[model samples]
Target: MKLWIKLAAALLSGACTVASAQNFPNRPVRIILAITPGSVADAIARFMSQDLTARLGQPVVVENRAGGGGAVAAEACKQAPADGHTLCMLHVSTFSLNPFTMQRLSYDPFKDFKPVTRMFFINEALVVSPAVAARSVEELRKLLVANSGKFSYATLQLPGADYFQAGLSEQWGAQVIAIPFKGGGEVVTALLSDQVNIGYAGAGNFAEHVKAGKIRMLAVNAGSRLKEFPNVPTFGEAGIKPFKIKAWWGMFAPAGTPEEIVNRVNTELSRSLADAKVRQYVEERFMESAVTANPAEFASFVRQDYERGGALVEEIKRAAGNK
Candidate 1:
């Protein structure tokens, strides 16, 4: 009788676990945003959260825990229980570039998080202040070469955006100085204030500035011209061949979250991405929906991005010869 009772207890425990996993997210779900309120990241999170709330039958809330180049929010998500209730919207720079930029990182981009789905891709645009003489990408390259080291550009981050600018300078044989700012908003402010001759930032961040004639988008770092800015030539079209780098956003959960839960989230996110409202929201915001990928595919994409970013960092380190 003792043995039978033990067996029954074990089965009951297993059944309860299964039931809990199945019911998953029985309460409200929280999404941690690594950026401050009113930021582009926050805006995207809000849009997605609203859609998810309707689809999941649970309130989806976005909580901003901004700091440390997104490490703060990421760490918070990492420390959260490995339940589907707590998740984060991981940016490309945080997951892929931070590892290469920061000397010491707290969490493993891969091992510490389970990727759910890629939300959207925001391509960066290379824009010059109207005060600059250059109008097109080639013209800008020539102007930079002629002025060599006289031209300065601003980027949001040190090793991510600035590193890409460094690579562009090397590839184009231009002596451009890269100035770092706290965020994209500051970068735009500096460009508008004529504090910097050139700046690199997401199209969404500079859409109004570009429209206002405060900045001229010379070339876009995308395979082709974006739908919103079709008139603006791509880097390739402007003779700056092989210049494509897209900043992506994706959903992630704490590592060790149940596979079933992760799959459920991924499925819902995938559906959300496909919804006309979501697509329209992204389009209006100058973002493009990335092709939907499952957990394995998202993991592979993150790994590839990490490797690519690492290589870029190595090249920058070699060029600068700094520790």
Candidate 2:
């Protein structure tokens, strides 16, 4: 009699889990943003919410919890119930940078959340204000060396930007001040207003300004010259070896969420992102679609990135010391 009762209980528990997964998102679903509005992450989240809502039979909302280099949003996601209802849109900074740089991180990317899929990857570019007389990266490097300690570079509070500033300064035997901002939008604004003479961010951020002749794009990390600016050289072509790093935005669910539900969301995201509109949007934004094969694949990718972040942190510190 005891054994029968135990088996019944186990069967009921399994049934409950299955039901929970199937009925996932019975209410509104929220995708928290780790950065400020007007960022590429925000744009992509807002763009996909409608489609996700329709597919899930529930409203999908985007909430910005920007600050602390993605800590605020990450904490919110970590504290949320381990259900499919709450998700977060995190980026390279959250998974790759903060773990190694922050003195105290509130959550672990691997322990606190489940990676759904990588949404997109962006390539960084070096842009200078029109006030600067450099037309190309070589020219800019010479200028920086000649005018050491006379320039300031604007960056989002992430290691990638700071790493570049440090690496370039050491390479060119120059010293450029680093001014950190809260978001990409702020960095772009600073560059546009000439508040900073140098800026490093997604090439998309400076596309229009470059066209307007307000800023000059010296080089990009896109592996080749951009189609839009055929004359602009890649970092490799400009004489800098390719930086072995990636900047991507990915979706995550609170840890302990059912694998079934996680797969469901991943499937929907894949379908939604396959739309022609999304592809066009990605291209226009100067990004590449980076949907992973599955959740496990994304998890593996994160683990690799986390390791890379640690090594890069050490390299960044060394570069800073050399500067």
Candidate 3:
């Protein structure tokens, strides 16, 4: 009788666990953001949260941890329970650049996290102050080469040792100085104040300034023209086809999360992306919608990006050494 009772208890416990996993997200879900409130990442998080809440019938709360260039929130997500209720909305830097730039990271981006789905890809643009004599990308390249060390370009950080700016300098053979700032807003301030002659950041950061004619956009780092800046040519269009980079954003769950729960979250995220309102919001925000990919496909994409970014970082380090 004792043996039978113990067996029954074990079976009941296992059944309860299975039931709970099947239902999934029985409580409010937390979406962690690694950047400050009112940032582009935050805005994108909020947009997804609203659509997700409506579709899932549970509130999706966005919590901002904001420090260490997204490592704070990323580590927090890493420590959270792998129950699918806790997830993160991470930018390109979180997975690609941070791993290469930081000497020590608390979590392995690929090992500690599971890819859910990509949200959007934001194309970066190269902008110069009106005072700079560069109307096009070709002209900008000539100016940068001619001026060389005389001019400085401001960016969010020290080109991350593997970031787009560092790679760009190597490709162009220009010795333009790099000025590191705290955030995108500061990059703009440095440019406006004449502290920096040129800047490279998200197109969203310069959208308003470009519209105001305070700064001139030489070229975008996209394969084609951006909808928001139809007049601004792509690097290819401007005859500098080698310089192209797009920063992407995606959702990730902690590693060891149940496959069923991962699928559920991916399903809801796909639904959200397909919604007309969500599409419009992303388009207006200067984000290109991610091509629909299932969990396995998304994971493969992440791995490819990781390897590509690693190679890019190596090239950057080599260039930095030569300089």
Candidate 4:
């Protein structure tokens, strides 16, 4: 009699779990953005919303909460119910850089959230203004060494720019300045007006400008040469140490979300990217498609990136101190 009762209880538990997955996201779903509108991540989030709503049988909304280098959006995501209704868009900065760079971080990335799937990976380009005479990384280094304290670079909200600036300064024995901007558009403007000598950002930000011959891409932090810019060499080919961490965007839900719900969302998002139009949009934006086999794979990637960020922070500290 005791064995029969136990088996009945187990069957009931399994039934309830299946039911929960079927009824998930009954209301409108929200995707919190870590950056403001007009950014690459923001555009992708908004693009995915329509397809996700159809696939999930509910409305999907995107909300921008950009500030604190992704802390504001991250906090909002952490506070949301772990019911898979509220998702957040996080990049390398959120999982990798923020913990080390930002003080008094309100939420722990691994503890506070669950990885869904990586949306895309952006290859960061190190570009120089047309006004600058440098044509390659080697030339740029020579220019920096020759003109210390006279060159500056504009960066987005992430502190990785500071690391790049410091690394270059220490390596070349120059005073390279890093100016922070709120968005990529601002960074582009700074470079276009020759306000800054160089700019480090996603290749998409300067795609049109580069084609127009307004800015010159010295090097890209990609594993191989980009097809769009086959002539441009990678950092390794340019004789510079490639950045250890990659800049990628992924989806996340508040921790404690049911595994079934998380998997369901991941499946839908993957299907959405499979659409030809979506794939084209991503490519035109200069983003590499970075879909993972499963959420566990993404989680593993994040853990590795987190360790790399720690190493980078130490390197930045040493470089800054030496300078």
Candidate 5:
């Protein structure tokens, strides 16, 4: 009699789970970020929130849980119900950089969050302030070798900028310190003021400044020359190799979120990216909108992102001799 009762209860529980998923997102949805409120992360999150609320017919909100290289927001998402209402919108760094850079991460990015969709990829660029005489990367490297302790590398929210800077410094056998700022805006400010000699930052961060003649881009990490700068060379053309540190953004929900909700969220993202206004906004920021596949494909890519991130971090640590 007890065995029969337990079996009935299990079946009932399974039914309830399916029923809840069908009524998914019955409440307000919230997206959390680990960046400052006015940052690119916040802007994208708010934009997505507005679009999702309109389409999903729920009051979607943006929550800023900044700090600890995105651990703060990620952990908050971890503890939330896996109902798909609560989500995290984060940079590629949270998965690609934090694991190796941060000494202790509170949650496993892979296990705590389920991949929903890839939002966009920001083209990264290497640039120098007008105070620096170097016009190209080769020239810049030579200048650094000559004036070893005089210049520095500016890093913003992208912490791995330091790792790449360090790698460059090691390769060139020069001393270009990695100076970190809170956001891209600040890095732009410092670069403009000649407080930092050079920086590897999102192309969006330097676009206006580059146009105003405040700084010069040494090389850009893109497939080919951008229409805006038809004359500039790509990293490969500049003889800079394997420096493909990606600047991408993705959306995710709590680990236990139902697969149905995950697929729904991904669909919503695809729709938003296809929106003409949203695409224009992304382009204005010097970012390219993504063409993401379905949930399972994105999840597989997320797993690969972590694996590649781990290997890159390990390589950096070994090169720096971090025991």
Candidate 6:
């Protein structure tokens, strides 16, 4: 009789767990950002967060934890409960950049977090200051060769930009040393001030400067010709066959979060991201909506991206004579 009572209680507990999973997010949800509030990352988070609030029938809040190259926020999110109430907005850097560049990371990006959904992916642009005379990749190659060690190029460490710039230098046999900045804004500032001759960063960072004609983009790594710069060609079109670089955005939850809750959030995220306004905002910023259908597919993509980045890191090290 005692044995029967124990079995009944176990069944009841399992049933309750399933029902709770169905009605998850018993309270407000918080989204943590690794960068500042005004960045394109932050803006997208804010835009989609509104739809998330409505779709989930819970208030969604975004908190900025901008320090340590997103490590600060990544750490905070990892330590939180796995109830699906907390999610972190990670850029390509969180997975691709930090792991390759930083030797000691406080948290394991792969182990400590579970994929929620990809947010956006944008191409990088190789732009030069107006002070420089290069107009094309070929011309820039010649310039980078002539300038060599005499010139410096700006990049950010957050997204592991060092690998991209280093690879470019190796491909062209240019010995220009890479200078690391905190983020894209600093890269743009260095270019504008003539503090650096060349910069590799997000298309959005260079969009305004390029439009104002303050800088010239030699080539882009976009899926197609950027609508804003219909005349410029992609890196492949420009004969840069050895390398292609892109920036990405995504969301992650604590590792132990139930698969059911993960799928549920992803479902709502896909639907909300499809809203006309949010889609328009993403499109206008030279970003595309995530093509993932659910958490499993998105997790696969994140893993693949990380693996690809590892290969690039090794290639760059070999080319730069640093390995």
Query: What is the number of backbone collisions in each predicted candidate, taken in the order shown?
Result: 0, 0, 0, 0, 0, 0
Q: Pick the candidate with the highest lDDT.
A: 4
Worst 10 residues of 6 by lDDT: 155-164
In model 2, the clashing pairs are none
Encode model 6's per-residue lDDT on 1-323: one tens digit a residue.
99999999999977876776787988999998877765566677888888899999999999988766678888998998887899888777778767887778888978999998887886778899999888998998888788777778886654344666667666777876678665667778889999998888777778888989999998888777898899989888898864533578888998888788888988888887788888898878767676755777888888888887787777776765752
Indicate which candidate wins on TM-score: 2
Candidates by lDDT, descending order: 4, 2, 1, 6, 3, 5
User: After superposing candidate 6, which stretches have Cα over 4 Å from the reference?
Assistant: 1-23, 67-69, 158-161, 242-245
TM-score of each: 0.87, 0.92, 0.87, 0.88, 0.88, 0.87
Q: Model 3: how far is 93 from its true place, Å?
A: 2.4
RMSD of each: 3.2, 2.4, 3.1, 3.6, 2.7, 3.0
Task: Give the CA lDDT, 0 to 100, for residue 7 in model 6.
Answer: 100
lDDT string, candidate 1, 1-323, tens digits: 99999999999977876787799879999998876665565777899899999988899999887666678778998999887999898787777678878878888888889999888887678898999998887788888878878988886655443556766666766767777664567778888899999987677778888888888998787767887678999877877655334578889999988888899999999999899988888767777779989999999998888887777766766766532
Q: For residues 1-323, could you state the per-residue lDDT of candidate 5 as single tens digits?
A: 99999999999978877887788778998888766665565676687678778988889998887766667778898898888888888776688778778877888877888989888887778999898899988998898889887788887544542556655755776767778765666778888787888887677778888999998988888777777887788878888775535667888899988787888888887898888888887777667777877878878877788777777776766766742
Which pairs of residues collide in candidate 5? none
How far off is residue 240 in model 6, in Å?
Answer: 1.8
Give the runs in model 2 whose Cα sits over 4 Å from its true position. 1-13, 159-161
- Candidate lDDT (C-alpha), each: 0.80, 0.83, 0.78, 0.84, 0.78, 0.80
Better of 1 and 2 by lDDT: 2
Name the TM-score of candidate 6: 0.87
The lDDT of model 2 is 0.83
